[model samples]
Target: MKMTEVSFDIETVPSTIRYYLKNATFYDSSCSDNAKTVFVKGADGAFLKISKKGSLEREYRMSNFLSTHKVAPKVFAYESDLENDYLLSEAVSGEDGTSELYIENPNKLASVFGEYLSMLHSLPTEGCPYKNRTAEELNELTNKEASLNILTEINYSAIDDVIIHGDYCLPNIIMDNFSFKGFIDLGYGGIGDRHYDIYWGIWTLNYNLKTDNYKDIFLDAYGRSKIDRDGLTYFTQLIKLCD
Candidate 1:
């Protein structure tokens, strides 16, 4: 990781500039030890994210696609060396939902999150080049001993396809004084069930805040028109099994 100068937006000069490494691992949920996030502060006062090689191809692809029509951060540069791949992106400005600012308004937080998720699920997935297939996800759990018992519980009959964030937790979303900003960590993003993300949304809130109060409120705010309660339960159970 050299402190070389880099600029993404301006196209006239086209030269490398150094950036300061901020955080080595922005999130704690990296699926593999080799996969990590490196946050950097650019000379132009922008934030850029760099990730391990071989791990961010999908993220780069999906982020570019989402940035075109949604509130995703802009991609700057994606490169790789011998040991690591790098993805440089403009950071989503503002504090995350996990910050204390939202602590006073958990009800509003849950409702707004529900609406944001609803809008995300409403996006058309046509020509989308990725998918978070159940079978593929299940394979990620095969090595876990607890996953064996839950194997029989896997029901492939239900599917509500949409372009999902894959990991729809609080930290992945950003907000400024309770207003929505944008999304981050699109590594697991693809076409999948809306319930998968919803389950994670509820789980992340409860896990981070240490409360169960907002689950029902969020679900209610999300509306019942397109959600399947049984599907939610099933997907939640599947995630628990993996854990």
Candidate 2:
């Protein structure tokens, strides 16, 4: 994942870390070489984005991944510099949907997230042009064996054939009020089941974490009495292995 130093004259504008880049360890090599993402105000009163190399290729490849959804940040371009990669794009208009509003108002969390996530899953999967994952696909993705009974035990039969936001948790969900802008990190956005989205969304809240009542609130908001809780439990355990 290293890039050969090339003297590509792309005078990168100065940047700042408006917030923590999701993963610190791979912030450069695994995430972005110029991992310090910034929010700069332009003369026109709009925020412009500037990114440096690292995992630009992988990120760029998934640039269009979340385009179908109206909520994602609009990407401007990804071009090769002398010896590195660079990404330019428009900034998201609002704060992350998982902001103070939702956190402080935890009860509003599930209902808003429920309907928003459903909209994401409802996107047409036919011409998605992205990889769709299954239990078997996941198996090939890791050293641990993925289980097929994940759906059955989790009671996930009701929802299928929709896009699964691999990281459907809060951070990735950007919003201003109830207006969800779009999704980010298309790197993992692809076709799958409805439960996958809901499962992770509730698990990672870290607030009502480890509590079934909080998760139930989300389901209640989503208007569902039955879901594959077992499947979510399994995935949560699986994700823990990743940590």
> Best-fitting candidate, measured by TM-score?
1
lDDT of 2 by residue, 152-216 (tens): 35543333477777777776676777577767655565666566677677776654433555676
**Per-residue alpha-carbon lDDT of candidate 1 for residues 66-183, written as tens digits (9 for 90 to 100):** 8876668887767666655666677666767777777678888888888888888888887667865565677877787676566466554546478888889887787887677888
Q: TM-scores of the models, in the given order? A: 0.78, 0.67
Residue 104 of model 2 has an lDDT of: 72
- The Cα local distance difference test for each model comes to 0.70, 0.55
In model 1, the runs with Cα more than 4 Å from the true position are 1-45, 141-156
Off by over 4 Å in 2: 1-10, 13-34, 43-54, 57-65, 82-84, 135-137, 140-160, 207-213, 223-226, 241-243
Look at candidate 1 and tell me the lDDT of residue 56.
Answer: 76
